[model samples]
Target: MSMFGAVDLSSFAPKQGSTPAEPAAGAAHNGRPGGLVVDVDAQNLREIAEGSARVPVVVVMHSSRAQASVDLVDLLERLVVEYAGSFQLARVDVDAAPEVAQALQVTAVPTVVALIAGQPVPMFQGSAPEEQLRALLDQLLEVAARNGVDGRLDLDAAAHMAEPTEPEETEVERQAREAIERGDWTAAEKVYEHAIAQSPADDDLKAARDQIRMLARMDGQDPVALLAAADAPGADLDTQLAGADAALAQGDVNACLGRALEAVRAHTGEERERARLRLLELFTIIGTTAPEVARARRQLATILY
Candidate 1:
């Protein structure tokens, strides 16, 4: 059985001519190495899946006509470059690779699945918020770690080609980095907070503050313990909150958000308000623009009013 559930895609095979001719060397977008992102069809699907023994392979089933599909492809491509080859992305056009889609049982245009040691682990369907996707990828890495599939691609060439020169860091940014290095999150937070207060309109400063706050919340905490406590019978709201914080620190955005939302539904009066307010704060940490936040925001409204 696949990690997500039982999935039998072994019988499906890509029809001939459905596969595109292999691209010449350096023909991929931005001259990315072939190992980073590869178009997969029935012919090479098994080979790529088996290669997951070395590194996690993210299979993205997409359609050309859907704007959401296009957006997801772009996001995955960006993440591929950002992750520097922690995993390989297998881009499968559903229309052209129906057998592959059938094998995966994809019911949506943008279904993502992870492969490790050739076993499929379903990830998500449709367009997921960027932050949520990042969290999911982090979890995927953890999964890879457990399975001994730890391999990193050399991204120096790609990074050099994509990154542009930047100005020297400001003194405040320098102080923040220094404080972070010394494990003084409070000092780091204060630096970013002060910078934000001075600028008042700098989104970058606000983002930095948010990141530092999340770091502080999870600092010196054991995530496994927190999660265990949160799941214990008769666990209190504070314990769950701690679990949520630890989850956020570990880049499990869904777990973080879900815990708070559950608290909101379970508590009442001041307790409910506390959960609601905390949820709002998490939304800020995750950025209000994320689709998960948007969905959670709507759900919050329904709970409150």
Candidate 2:
């Protein structure tokens, strides 16, 4: 299965290339074999959002009062460990966070959704057997890898600390990454663009290019300044779009998408079409499977019609 559609772990693992770098000392995956699972609530939802930018957060909306939900959670608790640190889990009791349930529109007790890069991905709204759950999770890992999200969380303080290792990159990617490290956005973008032109079907190259493009847009721009300019009284469409770009560059995906949607409603004619196109571009960058993209798509259509 493609998982998040047309994307797989190709971005995460190093494709066999010309040269291989020696493994660094003390490189290891973060967290223990048990994996990192957090008990989340409405008050700490920010934790889930922030963590998703680094890795996928599996949101398990369940009711402790429901035996089925309890059983499902226990099953998941056991399952997450087997994957090591591929993805972390977050469980929210509907009884404790009814507002969270309402916001997610979760109609069932044992709903499971994934938050990837601050966007929701609806998994399912009810219980499934362990076999099915395992299959879905396997697919999720593929999606995570494809999206370049293979981060690890810190283990409990009592446990020994181990730093996560970066995946090896193709030689061309190494060149691009070196450019990025040296703060040469133009060079990095050119590297990926050239490589992509040569290997047109390489999803990894495409992802790398998108990342460099975003970085180029964000280059030398202060987030606070951009946000202030956007919030200035009667800020025009261009200013707002700039602010939205800054937001997306800073991992504020919701704000970035929201600003574009607002622009669509607040403008008319050519400007409105620009806003609509911007939203579509963002959908492409973030992956159309994102729940945020789906919601914004509906909102854009409504506004257009």
Candidate 3:
């Protein structure tokens, strides 16, 4: 079994009537390993071989005409970026490079091969997730290290593989947005949470999530109900705070401000602090245009003085 489901050997061998040829410049799977991508054709044949000779290269061959193949290519690109610091990714259009395709014995529209030292080794065809691909890469690296090629290529592989994974992040964000657009608030929330969990420190994901949160607040909840519940006469600090939080969650900035101020007026230090922090978050969400932001800055200066 391969990292992606079960491995199918049908895609490994060359197609019928295809003859194996000696590795040549611009030849499918022919370029020298242990170096940067040099031959355009060869480079194209192997998705990523240069700078990753010791790490093994995953050549993703796809037909541009096939929708599934095209999608697989895009996913592969995302995986390349995600594992940029670990492996090299190169693409060969089977339709464009027919001989190379024939040489690789590709019978399918999308085939992915792991090549080490200029030889095709374990391969998986079809679309595989990034996690699965990474797993295979880890296994390949371990095997290579055991084979004595890791030490010489470790640094080079690391350097060659470090590409931005933001594209993947963006794709995730887009899917979340689409979910929200489809009125699937729970699904959207889950996706957004996943994105945040995966990258808690990511400012972009954080910002995008803030937008989603705002949208979620406007969906079914009634802002007035929350505010009234929080402000009912003689409400305890905790109850009021919960109500204020609900208001904030419903995108009711004014209600949050009023409830927070009421809590402060009652001499509730803890509630005051919570409201203050929530105010800061509100400003962050609403951006810098709020007059309260400037007032807050001046008040900070006065307090420091």
Candidate 4:
């Protein structure tokens, strides 16, 4: 069952009466950046167990002889690099820090514990996939965020993976952007419609599609004819917004604004917000100095509220 090679480490015991040791030079706390791997000798181990009474300490217990332990250390290193902001990651050699190891009752090469508010909270033990570790970190982060710990969960890092970060763009999105760039509203419409089939979570992609849909809807000569031919009847979602984009490009601000407003009526939640955002972006592109900019800002305020 061991992902790493088998090493029967069921008999290792922490030496008696050995006080926790000091961090041997580079011992980092909770994966904080630049926290170095410290030798978990007696003095460091005790310091970890009792020092730093404010921030929680995550103690990783490992055995050098165990291949699994080696692998766990490697994984911890990766987690630290990516998520050091979450917590400090420290390791203990059950072999060296016997007293402290005995105190924690660590029998395995790799055991993880989260110390929140200076109390030990158990995490994964043994080698685990990086995804699992990341998940655990996220759970802790959510708690940290709710508790307002450590300054708003590091927004920069959270934005990289948080729900608010734009979703993944689909092939539909790529095709749509291409069409728009080439000034081919017809082709743009088709690509955006296809993209909606995949419906990637990125708000920016959905916003782009909505812009195109708005444009397509307003391209005169055969307004109803175009919508009837290309856009679905009940499609007031992103694809419809793509048509609106086409309309805007054609200089039909009235129709573009109308379709965008209807999109607000038809779609709710994040999609509605995205539609509103597109219109605002349109306002900027067309020049905020214009009268329409003020109107668009009002609309954006209504939707956001």
| Top candidate when judged by lDDT against the true structure | 1
TM-score for candidate 1: 0.54
Give Cα-based local distance difference scores for all models: 0.74, 0.69, 0.54, 0.54
Per-residue lDDT tens digits for candidate 1, residues 126-172, read 67899988888888888776766676654554343443358899999
What TM-score, over all chains together, does every model reach? 0.54, 0.46, 0.36, 0.36
Model 3 misplaced regions, further than 4 Å = 1-52, 151-305
Candidate 1 or 4, higher lDDT?
A: 1
Where model 1 places Cα greater than 4 Å from the true spot, the runs are 1-14, 18-171, 265-273
Give the winner by TM-score: 1 or 3.
Answer: 1
Write model 3 residue lDDT over 81-174, tens digit each, in one string: 5654344555676534556656766655567766554456646766667677667767766654444334232334434543545545467867
The most accurate candidate by TM-score is: 1
The weakest ten consecutive residues by lDDT in model 3 span 31-40
* lDDT value for model 2: 0.69
Give candidate 3's TM-score: 0.36
Better of 2 and 4 by TM-score: 2
RMSD, candidate 4, Å:
22.7
**74-153 per-residue lDDT for model 4 (tens digits):** 88766755664455567786644555556665545567765443345556666678777777767655544443234212
